[model samples]
Target chain A: MKVTAATFTNLSPEWILLGVVTLLMLIVAFSKDKKQYLAVTVAAIALGFSAMCAFYHMNETNQVMFMGQYLITPLTSFLKFLTCLLMLAGLLYGRDFITSRNMQPGEYAILILFSTLGMLALISSNSLIVFYVALELLSLPLYAMVAMERNSGRASEAAMKYFVMGALASGFILYGISMLYGATGSLNLNEIAQQLQTTAVSHRVIFIFGAVFVVAGLAFKLGVAPFHMWAPDVYHGAPNPVAAIIASGPKVAAFAFFLRFLLDGHNGLVHQWHDLLIVMSVLSIVLGNVIAVVQTNVKRMLAYSSIAHMGFVFLALLADNPIGYRAAMFYVVTYVVMSMGAFALLTLVSKAGAEAETLNDLKGLNERNPWLALMMLLLMFSMAGVPPTVGFFAKLGVLNALVHANMTTLAVVAVLFAVVGAYYYLRVIRTMYFESASNHKPICLNWDERALISINGLMVLYLGIFPAGLMSLCQQFVG
Target chain B: MIQQVIFYLFAALLIFSGVRVVASRNPVHSALFLVLAFVAAAPLWIMAGAEFLGLVLVFVYVGAVMTLFLFVVMMLNLDEVPRSKGFVRYLPFGLIIVGLIVTLMLNVIDPSHFSLHVNAGMIVPQHHSNTKELGLMLFTQYLLPFELAGALLIVAIISAIGLAFRGPRARKVQDPSAQIAVKRNERVRLVNMEAEKKS
Candidate 1:
């Protein structure tokens, strides 16, 4: 029961992140100076290094660290690696964006690092208490980042809504944990699963009560239907890079969160939760797509599309197999890449004064900047699941998983929603390519920014054509 | 019999204050009533032999969290928050939810679940201090999660600072880094006029 040095080694990734954030915080605090460049460089280098080190730790599997509350397995390592990768990309895109907006890059980078750390812990957590704490650590930064633009009234409003709703979700999760503890006398996920199997039939109802609350709390985090009221507003009101983080990295982490708590803990209660997920998935897909088609704001539209995307990912959960989980992992990784590119482009194109909030902003994009236009076209095409792009394969992979699980009707409905979802993405492309410019000024980006965006965009196409590398990588660890 | 009397005493007041937390018209009153409910409920836990939980609940919830609730409630624009326009309309749904929860609890929770027939868990002597035992387990067995919870607080601090911090504006400011990075030749004259001032 003694804490040992090996415990630190097993938790190397988390320790490195902690060290980086603390160093950044101290440097920022001591100097009455804003060294935006130093902070960003330090964060980028540290995250990049930590992400590379994550591969070494992957060799250790099923080993518990810190009294069985933290586990090191291939799945945890892989998810952590992907999360770190997405976060590094986000920070790279955010650096110039944060500095240009007159926000302190040090605080911004610190919050992002802390949030990533939260997600890392969340994915590897083995206890309900650890999971809740990690979930908060993951979320607290987001609330602040959403309203990081303090001078903006709309940002403040969105921050309030997000905080209140997020706090409520946390409360629900806490209540569920307490209820489960009351029923099973255990907080460890594996122990809870074991205890549930032997629990009397009468007590299973109490377990179900807790299960429902936990599901609702998690659903709120995922921003799926009936619990998605906060997503679009937060996305639209937040700074573009912050919204990009919200939209991409935490989502995959949320899936890992779901998988751990459900499959690892409450697999005994499948009959209790299966139907609830089905309803949530269907509503999310239908409503997310339908609402998106009407949104004129590019960010809001993408927010809705992200919800629908989650609905598809939820289908993988319903499939309840290793292949399905791998498919989900692949789908999520691709979606994250494509979404990050789209939002980073949004960040780049928005002039310091006005935001790219509406469809009209894309008008004459081709005439103004052809390369930017091409990037948007490919990113949008990937989002729409067009062939030769990874989005199609991602969608196809998930659909095949569904069919293999004998979910024909759900698969058919999902395809219908996908078609509906495509309309808005294509609308964005049409505005960019077909329309003429109202104001004749080029969308300007620096060489580095331009290069960064180009690489991200090209990767979408490259990965789509050569999906096996990522797919096999996902399969090696998942399930 | 003494335990029964104490249980009933706390339980009655707890329910009454709990009802007032929702029914009170003023938000401030509701928050205060919530504190009252917490204070009343702690004794019930103590009566049930959960001495550690009782004291901690009082110390943490009533002492810390409710005080915060009062501070925030009093700072708010109470007039802006409508008191009862939608109350009547929402009451039915709220009541139905309460009804369902009570019904479920009644149907599923057996009396035996609350009785003292359950065996003592793990290891604790007849006079074991619950707080000490908890500390031992938490610091040793659950150290990682315990540390994670600490990290969560650090995040909370940063988040509060990020969201709420606005630099003091319209005032002259100095950067220490800029000052420290300055060379002697930059601001100080080569003639060394500063040394001449002593004369």
Candidate 2:
């Protein structure tokens, strides 16, 4: 809370995003409906600068700011940088989709910017209150973004479902936080950890009770099974671009939130929360993979796949070592990249005449737009964890962490479920390549978008081959 | 002893009104019971030395928010709607869950488990002000969350407008600019005297 020079300097990225949000608001106010498209480019540039600012301040790590309410660490800076970049990519992928659908691109961009600001704050949050506020700031925009398609009754219903579930999750977290505060008389994560280390056995029971609720709430936000009821419905019902945004940066931010809550705040009680995570992870892998195979809608399929992927992240987290955390970080980063690329391709295929939602919409995509189909093939292959893609390495890293922790049984079960998960992703590829084209029109994209998709697709391959650099960086930061 | 008696009286009243707020069949009655519950609870805070919180809760929540709730409930005419019939079917499960939760809470909050760090009989000094202490903490140590909550409100406003706002309506709206641009002569015309013969 002190008005120090370091505080402003450290928080430059958030200030930049907040400034961009205000600027977008003014632009939306002044400009006519059609002219508000300019806000997208403005927001993209602001996000680029924000990411650059985060990278520039990467070395100023481990500095607890605002009376230990906020943190600036190398890991947080890296996650923030990734979140901004992913949001920028998501915005680009969504640009044509929003404008074509007559959804206000200006408002869409503003909400994305606000959500990104919230993610940045969530990544840096060091205390329970900041975490809760940042989480709400992150979620409120998403609910509106999902409901932005005002003409669609389905989207409205999806928004309602998301709002109710999100409210319940927030309530759980709040109630747990209140209990934790009562038990420890502190809000700062490190202070809570310190208190827990010395607290009596009787106090530990209340702390564990609070931690159970908190873990359940975090699992809900992460969309792991048993708490993942809203993901598929929201994904299928929301507009494509909003789904893309939901699938990307927010996952990374949610991982950071998990780390702050469990690793930072309640590390002393790992043996207790560890059991809860095990049940959630096993259920997520089992249910997400099993149910995803039957999905006809591509969005719902991706939603289920995301649940399975988060299960792998939780597996890495279960190892409870630096290597395990690094693997979890790597897995989340890889998942975000693949999910963003896949959804962006979905946005591209969806034309004006018909919303390309079902698997049949993607039938024989190879014949109509081979390049776009190739990009999608790469993304799907990556998602399925084929040998040449980053997804394989990400899964491998998680398994490695699990084996290192001597949880070979869980590792084997994960591998089994992953094999089941691969069937659906390959089914997407099979529909694109093996099936006959029904919608004969070719999907035309601007050169820049095509190139962006190309880079997104190739990054999966390139990172798979050269993951040593990012892997080492993850290791270094987690250390 | 008098303070103890007052505490138990209002505490009982608070719990009773709280239950009635949920159990009342009439929505207006429920809202009124809620207001009473808020009123009953404010005294507890004041008695606990949080005078500012107690007064503000009464003023802001009871006076403004509960009154607004009452107006909305009355306007909605919810009493005309029939209640759901499945409550009896669900009551057993609900009671079981509630019982379990109460037991767990009682176990965790058992007074014997806690070694009190603060002396229970400590008295407040003359002219002590918890309001000032609360303000100082809010503006100093807790400022990050305070400001973040402000930002959250902005997001709430944006989402509210984004979801609810439609474009300009075709219905007639006031033209404030045109209203202000009217000249004196335009608004009121001077005319020559034209007296009618009917007078």
Pick by lDDT: which candidate is best? 2
Model 1: what is its DockQ? 0.51
User: Candidate 1: where is the Cα deviation over 4 Å?
Assistant: A200-202, A266-271, B59-84, B92-124, B169-199
Give model 2's DockQ, 2 decimals.
Answer: 0.52
Candidate 2: segments with Cα more than 4 A from true spot: B20-27, B73-79, B85-100, B113-124, B173-199
Interface RMSD of 1: 1.7
RMSD of each predicted structure = 6.1, 5.9
Error in Å for residue A108 of model 1: 0.9
| Candidate 1 residue-wise lDDT, A403-426, digit = tens | 988999999999999999999999
Against the native complex, each candidate's DockQ, computed on alpha carbons, is 0.51, 0.52
- lDDT for residue B97 in candidate 2, whole number 0-100: 84
Give lDDT: candidate 2, residue B127: 83
- Give one digit per residue, the lDDT tens place, for model 2 in A1-479: 45988778889999999988898899887887573767888999999999999998887748888888899988999999999999999888888888888788888889999999899999999888989988998999999999999999999999999999999999999999988887888888999899988988766887887877787887888899899999999999999888988988889998998987888676656777688889989999999999999999999999999999999999999999888999999999999999998888888888435788889999999988999899899889888889888998999999999999999999999999999998999999999999998888888888878988999999998998899999998998884
